[model samples]
Target: MSREFEFAQLLRAYRKGILSEKAFEEEMTRLEGGACGGFIAMGKTYASERDAIVAYLQRVRNGEAAGARALEQWAQVCKTDCMRSGLRTIAEREAYHVRVIDRKLNDLGARCEPAADPEIDRFVSMQSDPNISDLDKLRRITSSFANADEVVKPIYEFVDLIKQDLDAKEMLALWAEDEYSSIKWFLHACAALGGAAQSPADSRHEAMASAQTH
Candidate 1:
């Protein structure tokens, strides 16, 4: 049977409650293949309207809404993978990295004599707190880094390395055994950092302009 027909059959099974959402999504992923697999699965998995899955997949593949949706779906998949793999919780993992990076940045800041910012101080403290979620700590770290003029490059490099070490597809595969939200957030963070690195100067200029305007 054609892919569309197969997908349609899956959708019917999904709507009839013959297949759970997770199972339907996995089957779609297996059928579609590649990075696009997630998007296809997402479209087929969550769609309620007739042909909505097909339309969404087409939009995604055509370089329109697919990129954002795919990213979102990929993130969800990542969260699921992390939990199944028995990997360190994202919060724990990020907290560890944040502490390491924050310490290095703090030492650098001390040596450089950059003006102290309370936000940065709070961020450093948060990095070691197991109470805060990884996503929240990451936000705090990014915000704190942005507030500092001298620490910006170091922070960017640190985050860039973390982003580089992550393989979205591989990560997703790990969570393929289950579904979780944390992995999705992790993937989103990685994508955001990757996008930021690809245009650092532009982002800096924009930040500078925004700072001036404010």
Candidate 2:
């Protein structure tokens, strides 16, 4: 096969999760008469590795097998490179990490909104941190509202705290106004709190007999 065809096949394989970096490099080396020269030649035109990867990923998304493989390979390389380099600004690193998490969540068929369990946990953990700002907390809460299931407890607890702190009925009124969704969540949270509020014990054998009767 031509070098171009072989490279394209390698790219497709990588995208499909079939090729390892070592394996890809070995093939490229054998084909190009040296180690990674072919791939390096392809990579040199892009301004940044990330930009190149993004371009390849777009091609992959467009059903180009070679581009898809190149994108996947580049992603792995970029992640490792980022970790090893320690050159990224804090904000850049955080944004990149969040994007990675977002992609994984999307792949899992999760909503882009903040409703999932892990997303809620992340927000709650951040809120509990003494270093986090109130304005940031408000932002997170607002973003979280779009996916209410994940933030209901935190929202209730936060508003409840505000009600106590301000000694005002306004906070309570605001909470009450969201009663339909909040009440159901509150009930569920209460049931989850263990002790006397826990769900009733169920006998598996009794449930089986009941099911059989039906």
Candidate 3:
């Protein structure tokens, strides 16, 4: 059968309750053959939801650390206004978020073998390019966040599915809040720099709220 047909069959099985939700998601992961998002993005599904969450946590830490390190490097090369103190603060938060999440994963007896994402390297190169103006950088950042609704969807999915562990869920929520704050800071800065009519935070918040309802 074609891959598309196979996926349709899998969806039918899931909808009919022939497979448990976890099993359905795992099968989807297998079909995906790589990370898309959520607990499965660590590239495997555990026998238990808790274990799966631990794996997700490990991946989250690595992604956050990569972003943080890149942000710090960019800050060093940025012009004074571009660095803007806000950049440093967000970088610090991202760094600490990595450490905190890693500790949480280890506390659950999970070993983390994190992988670096090349996207971060590309982002750093883009930011550090002397040929690009900071106005252009601001625009790029705001434009990339056009899918603000889906940006943190994976985190919410993991939290909602985790029943036995409230701590992890709460931690993820707090992390989401920080992410929202960071985005707002950037957007507000963009507005200050003669860009955007509405505050980026206000517009994105509506998108995020809509995402949560769905």
User: Which number leads on TM-score?
Assistant: 3
The window of 10 residues in a row where model 2 has the poorest summed lDDT is: 79-88
Once fitted onto the true fold, the runs of candidate 2 whose alpha carbons sit more than 4 angstroms away are 1-116, 144-176, 179-214
Error of 1 at 195 (Å): 15
Stronger candidate by lDDT (2 vs 3): 3
Better of 1 and 3 by TM-score: 3
Ranking by TM-score: 3, 1, 2
| Backbone clash total, candidate 1 | 10
TM-score, candidate 3, is 0.64
Q: What is the lDDT of residue 106 in candidate 2?
A: 48
For candidate 1, write residues 87-200 as lDDT tens digits: 234434433433433343343332122244565445445544546544453454344233233433332332232211233223223322222334343333433434233234
Give the backbone clash total of model 3: 0
Top candidate when judged by lDDT against the true structure: 3
lDDT score of residue 53 within candidate 1:
25
Q: What is the C-alpha lDDT profile of model 2 across 77-193, one tens digit per residue? A: 332222212212322333443454345334434424422355434544564454653334334434424435544454344344321123222433343344334334323322332
Model 1 lowest lDDT segment of ten: 60-69
TM-score of candidate 2 relative to the true fold:
0.17
Question: CA lDDT, every prediction?
Answer: 0.39, 0.39, 0.69
